[model samples]
Target chain A: MIGGRLGIIVSGSLTKGVEVRLDSAISVEDIAVGRYVTIEGEKRRFFGMITDVTLDAIDQRVMATPPDVSDPFIAEVLAGTTTFGRLHVLPVLTIGGDALSLLEGPQPVKTVPVHFSVVREASEQDVEQVFGQVEEKQFYIGTPLDMETKVRLNPAELVKRSNGIFGKSGTGKTFLARLILIGILQEGAAVNLVFDMHNEYGWKGSSEDRREVKGLKQLFPSKVAVFALDEESARRRKVSTDFVVEIGYDEIEPEDIAMLRETLGLTDAAVQATYRLARRFGERKWLESFLAIEGREELNELASSLGEHEATMAALRRRLDSLRRLRFLVPHARDNAIQRILDYLDRGINVVLEFGRYTDYTAYILVANLLTRRIHAQYRERMERALGEDIAKPRPLVITIEEAHKFLNPDISGQTIFGTIAREMRKYNVTLLVIDQRPSGIDEEVMSQLGTKITCLLDNERDIESVLTGVSGKSELKAVLAKLDTKQQALIFGHAVPTPVVVKTREYGSPQSYKELGFREALELKKKAEEEAKDLWG
Target chain B: MPAKIGEVIEASSGEFTAQCYELHQPPSFGSLVKTREGEVEIYGVVSGAATTSIEPGRRPIARGREEAEEEDIYRSSPQLSKLLRTDFNALIVGHKEGQKLHHYLPPRPAKIHSFVYLCDAEEVEKFSQSFDFLSILVGAGGQADELIAASLRHAAAAHQDPRDFLIKAGKELAVLLGGETNRLNNILRRIKV
Candidate 1:
């Protein structure tokens, strides 16, 4: 640390955290929320994050002016606004060594930093000590807003549990989500499947001004497979396609349609009619045969022959016919589309299912729920089998879903497959990187399951309340949350990070940022995977 | 150069009292005055001044208006200046030992009857370079802000660069006053130009 005194410790009875005032060189207002400051302790150097900065008048004269002044301006000028600042910093990590190095990782504050110690801005070296050495396991998401030091998260922790990225619209939520996926890919810690509703993740996506950003497929071509519901849309955007996933009528289960009940605006009678049709024609072939009946002529023929209510069948057909326009559904041309996804995951290749221009909530929800449900069930079975066998468990999988509230809202959470994965995916090594504008819409149970959350600015009261979780020091954290810049800044805290830090997300799409984020390391792994593919073929 | 005003009659670490030797009336309140103590010189601002007989606990007898004036009785007595003594109380600002000046009270106060000099232009000009003395003056007992402002005007005029001296004093007061910008601004408004 610098030898100069930043401030003196005002309290000697400090037990939990130390209060150190800044020296005259700086003021309290100058220190921003979430800025990292260091205090010199008796035995070790303690690193603290500024949670609050308050201004106070030190003398009564500073607050009041003598009333006898005839000139108002003079009276105004004479009234003292001389204020002292009080910085509420929380000590997070403590280091013990003559020479502080990242290699000597800091431990959680076992002993609070010494009182009366000078507090200074946490230098790049001090910040790196808390985050520790940057290795394959550590993924640098961004640098802290106040310091130039990089803030990295443990990817191993990310894959072991579910996490979330939340922010209001235009707060760079998607950009942050893309960065996290890149981090997950660089580490090869998990096979991520991004359900791109707006077709933004797999192919080139431009920002508001059409600033073209390279998609995940473009970055790692062989490692990521771009699966689009409509091949034409993907081709129009020049997104190289690996597979065309189509959900055939025969493959649509009762649960798949049940997931869409609220979205399709279907009545309870309509859902029961579909079930009745399934029971009569057998569950496997019922959806295919039902789609075969196109008009009222066929509907009337099936109703009379099958001995069912004519109005109920007609309502069911109307709802089913309305959904036929969706490209994912086809009448028995091939087998299950989910098998293809399992094939990609089994091969350790990530899959990004682009919805093409299908950015609608209902379609995105239906497709994501159908595929994730089948795949997550398969994973649950595989995990159970792995427990009994000697073979290693399958590689961890993280599914990135956008508009997460549509599936996880309390209204649908009880039946939505996405909700199931959110609450119980950890045991199956299948976690979610759910992204949304309204985190408050998600069920409280699923919110609690989120192991780590990287949230940008959220103004909605409920959204802020939901994102804050039940962490201690919530009021202080809320203050920090309220001050987050609307662009490129995030507060990361929870299981994946040792402490909460506000980071200015590194520039995405910049070649230099890509290199700094370890894109080369991932490319090397891609080459190795190609080699292994060749050896297997030979 | 201003004339020598009086001699120090009593002294302490923070303040001293002086008896007028030649002047008809004591230096006006908040006047910049000085006295010598050994090799070093001590500085102070007059907090108060009074006229009384050399004899203790005495009050002058006032009769009706004399001559054509309504309040000229005291002036009519020509020997009053000789019979009575005038003294001023000065709050110690600092003392200069050698070439370096300290902005605090001196270790030793002025001696009895040490000749007190009305500060010359050079003396005031050199001391005005540091506004530290203003803190002591403002912190003194009565009407401190006004006294400090008055002292600044006198000192600023003594300095070669009066405008710059006043500006520097204003800056120092801005910090010392904390957020009391009105007081500092008023002082600056009064002292500027």
Candidate 2:
């Protein structure tokens, strides 16, 4: 059994963790890093992870002139007596044996286990006691290493603040994000507004193996709406989208253009010129009027009258002209896209805005920023009014964005609506689920503001460091994070979990997995059970 | 029952010397032997044995050159048997009082002229059940590795699984001589089944 006694605590401290001398029968090679272990102290049971394994000898001379261990008798005798395996264990949480602690559950360990305490491999029940079983608010994300016990992530606490899902390219960030979104939807924690960059979260998404998997809309048609920016592209893919969305020129604000300065390659003067143009023309008419001044003589005259450089105005015009090529941008939109999204969110239905063919940074940044700013303003107004009038506050809304560094990077994070939501939007019932491949590019403040972070294998040193910044036992977690398997494995920690845990992510792309994820088959199974019950009763 | 092998001629708390009753005969070296002082039974391992002239100043000359065989000389000189006595030295490893066996020195030494007996297989098995006496044997001075190896080999023969017994004893020696890898290797090489 996995609960067999592993070893005893030989030496350690509260901060540096403890060292365990393994039993002779347990070979050092059998002990793996990141495996869960529990120490049975006199007063408490401490749970920890194996961070390092080392071969130790009782005598230094034995190493220099090694005994002839080719003989089984000699090897067996020397194994535990003269040589043994040592494990470096970081005790993270303590499940106190006292009655008060039993009621309180696992708490962060403030003291180390006593010397020579018995340490053993953590059993399934012990893990369940710590992470808990799948409950209403707790979502089963995955299983820990060499264990079947589910590691449940608390979606209720997760939605209370912004979160980030990070990994290198092709590390299944989208798949993980989709699972978390499904968790939020399933538990009714909050309504999600996903800015689907590559149409990955709406109707269908292709896995790494190229198999088409059902997206959120196909699974929960009534509770999900897929809005497409390019309807022709959506039609080509045969995705039955809920609505086609467009952005009018008048809807663009000076701040929106200012946030897009990097993506549009606008200089400082050009970025500032947006504010000047908004002042010259009305805030609602600035973009349309700026585009209307086509001739060079009229542009120069307008620039002179506005006390702006002609060259700067020309550069700003040239950069702004690129937005004209985007098919979704028009002088006037058929229906207000922001109102449609807010209405769907207010009705407790999630909305996924599919970029369709416009998956570039320019288009993604422009559309996501413009739509979110207005929606956030609406939420802020409603929240302020709710506080003043004491009416029921708006339902919490989580806005999901990909390539978050583009908006939350240090240079533009102060002005982007996504950055504002990440920093202090929890009071307004709005949080951001930022997905990015390069977490290092994101601002430090935003990264630290994240409530919980679930990341896959990232070998970059800076990325790993940034993800583990401000975390206690950072070095131990770094070792665990660096050794993660590249596929379907993740390390989750922060506000939602009591301790950092490495998990083999749950299955996501099969008929069986779909049923487990609560697809239509689950409803059919429920109905069948109900019918059987009715027959038995009647 | 144990075989009566000798009589304690020299006695001390840590060790005792016994002279065999028969000529040129002594229990095998490193064999388990026990002697008594009143009610306490003191256990010892036969560290060494020798057959020499009983007198301290005299030496014996070889008369076997002209004899047809070595036995003829001893037969011709009947006094030679009395002249040369086989004496063995046993290091006190443990003692037994009442029903409990202790792996430590007794409060008193073996009495002079006390009978010494070679322990039987059952007694050897009972004594070898705990390896605590091993520390005493390891620190018993000269040729300790060889003495430990011989005693363990003799004790193994008393168990059902000789190899398991030797391995268990070998582990004890390994811990006792943790810093002396060469000595441990020598003992292991000798004791391994």
Candidate 3:
């Protein structure tokens, strides 16, 4: 049977949600917060989630001097009449119960259900109707709590704006990110440019139990390109690399250093001095020229000539000297790494740039910021040209970055390219898929700008608050988000899903899962084709 | 036909007093009994019963001092049966109008001298189908809890499943006495099978 009738709407309001009085026959133990339910009103059916449960009695004296309920007879009699359970439901969408709703589908509820409306646990059909069925652009992410019905997320709507995936460490953020990436790929929504800091996405990544799972390249070889910053590390891991990305010292600019001020512990004067050096040596030669200065006397001569404070100049030199230790940075590059990435993205091939062993904060911030700044500028130019000439716009791009707080923290969000993309990059056909553990550390404005947010269990009060910032029914959703399972569970809301839902993230990393995701080797496909041909001939 | 238990000796809209056919043989406390007035049948539960001297203020002397058994005194003085009479009081819980049974006070009292009969198992089963009368019984003033416990026990005897019936009746009492937990608990203790 579909969900049996649980209760009736006893008393409620539109702003504070509705209260349901449970029937005497239903036990309160069977009810859980965050479970979905439907209310059959006079005119339409409303869908909502259970947010709270309470035990109540008709008279306060019954609680003061309690009845002798030790005997089963007294207990049974008093179970519902003298004492009962009450539920608090937040109605979100009105399911099809009227002619208008029947044609247009579910709509956001603007009114409360009439008094005494019946409420039942949401059935599979009701859930499927509200979340929609899997079709061309809809990808199945996971099932709602305790249900077998799949919840579909439309990747097409998802890539139109920036989004975030957050959780505490080891809360399966990586696994969910992988699933979303696969969703984007399957839907062909946009081309992904992932800054793979730990080399997790390009090749095989380990699960929590240290089991290796196939990466994106293994799943779609022809559609994905893996670029490694450390050639030796990529070879060590036995991963086939498509490109080696190295940043030339001449490629570094003053603004890139300014964004890294906090990570490098550089003083304000030191940051300002980089601009002076850039102006003196020209935009492309500042870092190479500054690093070539040999001794304190020569540095002092330049600082005096430029009228820069001696201490600030020395500190800037010392900080700039640390950049030499990063093996991927050289005086000159053999090829343009940004242009190569652009070429791959233009051809609709997703690129995962592996940092390999340089997972240090300084390196990740510098390289990611430097590359994104130039790339965003190029995209801006191209988008304008497309608009002016009435030509086809560039393919939509989604940049995936981890440890996003480092780049999007309040101080640097005003200057970093990631912030620009997050704020208003949709006009230029670019967006960000930010993955972070401390969402509280990200700028509030940027967090609000995210199109959709999928978050795992976050026990910290601040992180939970940050994730639910601009969402309607914030307090109610906070309870659901806080109660999510530590692994393989998340609460997704916003643009893609019709309403907020707590999902047991779809399974990944097994042979059966791989098969379901359409993973096949070239030889196997060819063999199958040959057998089909043989069957046709015979 | 059911045995005639009594006749109404005194009547009121809410309650009626009936004289049993035999001395010292009034109906049991809380058992249901009924009487007819022309076309209407008025139902009531036996609230209290007593046997006393036929005339008020007439105290009889002891006559069984030398008798070996209590029956010998009554046998020796045959007129004793005429001197003593038993009567019972029933609160008008409901009445039968046409074919329907209501759980409310009838429009008029059972007529004086109306013949009363103790309801059988089938009638008791049919009458107890709805618990709407429990509210009237609960509000019947002084020792109402005891009267309710006894009535439900007697009513449960007519059902195939007595414990299930008692539980259902107990739940009804729980709702009616929702504000009085102690009274409900006391009655539930008596009615539990």
DockQ for each of the predicted structures, in order?
0.14, 0.81, 0.78
lDDT by residue (A1-538, candidate 1, tens digit) is: 2323456566522233456665544555466888887778766777777787665554566457433337543333322234356677777777655344335567666556555777777878777767765764457887886566777777777878888899899898888888888788877889999999888778677654568887787676667899888888888888788888888677677777877787787777777777878888888899878877778888888888767678878877777777778876777647557888999989989999999877776678778988888899899899999998967888899999998888889988888877888888588889999998999999999988899999999888889899887865566678888889998889888888878889998888777765666556567887899999999998
RMSD of each: 6.5, 3.2, 2.6
**lDDT, candidate 3, B25-129, per-residue tens:** 888888889999888899999999998899989977899899999999999999999999999999888989999999999988989999999999898888999
Worst 10-residue stretch by lDDT in candidate 1 chain A? Answer: A73-82
**Which structure is stronger by lDDT: 1 or 3?**
3
Candidates, ranked, TM-score: 3, 2, 1
Tell me the tens digit of each residue's lDDT in model 2 across A504-535: 88888898777667576447766888999999
Chain A TM-score values, per prediction = 0.86, 0.94, 0.96
lDDT of 1: 0.77
Q: Candidate order by lDDT, highest to lowest?
A: 3, 2, 1
After superposing candidate 3 on the true structure, give the runs of residues whose Cα lies further than 4 Å from its correct spot: A135-138, A520-538, B60-64
Across residues A383-473, which tens digit of lDDT does each residue of candidate 3 receive? Answer: 9999999998999999999999999999889889999999995999999999999999999999999999999999999999999998888
- The TM-scores of all predictions, comma-separated, are 0.77, 0.94, 0.95
Q: After superposition, how far is residue A515 of candidate 1 from its true place, in Å?
A: 4.6
